[model samples]
Target chain A: MAELWELSAAALRAAIGRGEVSCHEVAQAHLDRCAALDPRVRAFVTLTPGTALAQADHWDAARARGEALPPLAGIPIALKDNFCTRGIRTTCSSKILGDWQPPYDATATRLVREAGCVLLGKTNLDEFAMGSSTENSGLFTTRNPWDLDRVPGGSSGGSAAAVAACMSPLATGSDTGGSIRQPAALCGVVGMKPTYGRVSRYGLVAFASSLDQIGPFARSVEDAALLLQALAVPDPLDSTSLPVEAPDYRAALTGDVRGLRIGVPREYFAEGVHETVRTAVRRALDLFCDLGATVEETSTPHAEYGLACYYIIAPAEASSNLARYDGVRYGIRADNARDVIGMFEETRDLGFGDEVKHRIMLGTYALSAGYYDAYYDKALRVRTLVKQDFERCWERYDVLVAPTSPEVAFRIGEKAGDPLAMKLSDICTIPVNMAGNCAISLPCGFQDGLPIGLQIIGKSLDEATVLRAAHAYEQAANWQPRVPSLSP
Target chain B: MPRLTLAEVEHVALLSRLRLTETEKQKLADDLNVILQQFDRLQAVDTREVPPTAHAMTLTNVFRADTARPSLPRAELLHGAPEARDEFFVVPRVVDTE
Candidate 1:
């Protein structure tokens, strides 16, 4: 019998269809794994064990009764706490929301539930997905599965850590900048950030709503693609969600990369990138070239401006999005207040973390009356150039390639004091979000025993190409077999 | 480069609605100064004629249908409130006499 957790979603569905393994047994095995590993890692905030088991039993009975099931039948998936799960405490990893239980599921969460994905639990995140290291999680910092002391890259760190540790085969992650990809890279798992608006953000707590996107973190490119397929339905509740037919993302993996034009931005190879990361990226590129794809050098002139522009825009949007969390509406409220403003101040002051406050303040400054033209408006203009640069390249190349992060995962608290260094860590991934394109971070290779990711970026709604290219590279490199030995 | 004073840091924090401790205020002032020094570097670029972009690459007007929708039910929506009277969440009033 196939070990339940080791089987891919495709294989699991097949086994369930063939009656080799019942959905209940598979889910139970995953739950058992979660029980075994989650305590040390602190990957989850809530595990609805009964709900997951009941859902699996429902699927199992349906299968036993000759009922046709959905594509993701019996697949166990975890959700980032930011994606509200009805009746589950969706804290977004902040004390403000510590006791808040969302009454309605986010659009994507509901869709995943309807697809028969067993909800294992809600994973931890950076308070409001603001920080890079899961260390910023207000509840508990999730440790990297590869090395316990190290961080699993944040906001989506818990999701990445859980998937990497085999606590769950798949999990939902939201990326604004590199939240999904960076952590996935650090954790040695597959993280996909679909083109902005490709997945519904209806249920996702607002974090720079313009750039925030829902994607997947999984053990493999194919598994990530499967999660995307299930989650990509256009949600009407999210006005920004694009109305388009979801692609057969898994099927797109069949085609070869022959004649495909892959561009390596000349600027990406320059200053500040670590040597090992560059080497891993080059090796991945070499693998693509060996697969008959043509590798060419290109430049996005405004790429260097991505970080500065992102800092302004993301914080500005975040400030606006987070303004909803006033003392009254939702989340924690101060016990006693002399006045409404005092209550607001007390609630928010106690609720948000330092980084969150810093961004909100910076954003508020940028959008302030005198500074709007000099900052936010100027950043928007720079944003135009960056997008144009991507368009020009895509017109010539099928996809763009680069190292997902500048370096391998730094130890937890390494850059905590130096916010600028932490901000620069997201340099490469930020531009993709700015341009609203899709990107994937796959385990290219490792640096000093820690994994590095090679990024494959695609045009908008072009998740198939992103997945295809990453899948091809994953297969060519066979990085799947090199899963970190976590049993020790 | 703009040097942020302790008072300026306090003002910014006030605008940000954060109640910073004395140490936090001191630390943020220094950090903000360094951050501003970096922002000053961007001034070298002659963006006099450049238009700032908020959304860089993809198509705009990624829209959904404009239709009336029912509001969230009163009770369920406000379930997490720490203090509430009737359907409304109660808080101290914002505008007040000092």
Candidate 2:
């Protein structure tokens, strides 16, 4: 059973193609795994076994007719609840949107369906993708597959945990502030946040529009590249989607790390990082050095200010994006309202979680007339300094490598009381989003029996280089044995 | 560091349209105080000459041609609305008129 679950997505695709395993068998096997394990993990908000089997049947029929099938034929993938899927309840794990079934599919979701992938179901998330831990989710908090008590780092916690637990080979995740990579690091899986605008945000329920990017979560770097291939098409539906040539990222994984200049950000290691996590990052860097890569200590001087800028900018945008949920247009509505304002007041207060409401209020204040210059405007200026810091580093190195998070997965309720500590977890990560660069997090080593992730970030649209470095490191380390002690 | 007064927190909550009870307002004041103190660290950085950038890439003149496209059926637009009248979303008066 473990052997079957451990197969890479590429190998699984080959097997399904050769009739070695039928599409129905693949779908049923994953369903069975989810059924047996998901209760303990709580990774999925909704499991659509019926829809999955139907999609699998369509793939099987296409193959039987000897017709050309898509590249990802019959592969099971979990959809993050934030991505809008037509006819399916696309909740962002907020009670306000608990019943909203979007009539449109996000451009990325549509492209994935067109590629013949089976949509397993929508995974859980932090409400509005705001919190670092899934505890902020209105529905269920996703547990790290490695340890039931520990959190799968969130907003994309369920997506990372689903792939980590073998509930699915690949899943989609969106990262605004370490949503994808932090969770992937905690769950011992591969998660990529493509360069901003590389993937479409057309139907993704916006958290921070300027910062949010949709990407793939997978068991291996190559598998992530395959899913990235399926989702990277430019779409007119998203005005922010980049119109650059979509490169063949899968072919770029040459698995050779020789002469690649890897930058170790000096400020990232200065302090606040856990000793165990630092050791793991240092070991990964040493391995890169042994693999013929030149490791250099680089500095993103203004990185210390990232958390400040990200909080202001992300929440400000979130304040605007979430303004649509005034209760009259869609989803949950306050039935007992005496007036429109009452309806909005009652609906949002009851529907949004504490963290979501906190952000909304903070953002509204930040963007308010009196504070805009001091908070939001100044944060934007600091954001420019942070981006320039990265630009200077990119001119000297190929990619920047750092620990994805300062610490391993903490207990579920550990930092739930202190939101500042929660915000600090993304300190090393928020800069990438603010800089609008590409980054991938892959398992590097284990510390105290939990997995640690080494993050590789590249200049804008340098996902191929990031993937190559990660793939080479993953192959050399072969650290797949460190799957967290997660039981279904 | 910017200090958030209780009155300011109340005003912000009103702007965000969240009707907070007195107890909730007190709790938010405490939370917002800690968050705002963290922002004080940013004042230490010298960004005096740095130009603010909202986007990383240089994109310009992104306007699409002003050609009118087929519109969504007005009936369908109101299909998901909680309350609709005559193929339009029905709402209480937002701006009071004499």
Top candidate when judged by DockQ against the true structure: 2
Q: Write the per-residue lDDT of candidate 1 for residues B1-98, one digit (tens) a residue.
A: 44667887777777767778899888877765666666654565667776655554344665556788887778987777777888787667656668
User: Could you give candidate 2's per-residue lDDT for residues A1-488 as a string of tens digits?
Assistant: 34555677898898987788878888888999899899999999999999999999998998999988899998999999999998788889999985777877889899999998898899999998988778999998998888889999988999999999999999999999899999999999999999998999998999998899999999999999999999998777787888887789888899899999999998888689998899889999999999999999988889999998998999899888888988877777777787788888888888898998899998999999978988998998999999999999988899999999999999999997786998888988999999899999999888777889899999999899999999999999998575554544
- Residues B1-98 of candidate 2 have per-residue lDDT tens digits of 66888899888987898978888888899998899888988888777898888886666645667888986456654666677888667776677677
Give the TM-score of each candidate.
0.96, 0.97
RMSD of 1: 2.0
Q: Looking at candidate 1, what is the lDDT of residue A157?
A: 92
Stretches of candidate 1 off by over 4 Å are B56-69, B93-98
Docking class of 2: medium
Residues A255-315 of candidate 1 have per-residue lDDT tens digits of 4888889999977877999888898898888889999999998999888888888888888
How much is the lDDT of residue A462 in candidate 2? 86
TM-score, candidate number 2: 0.97
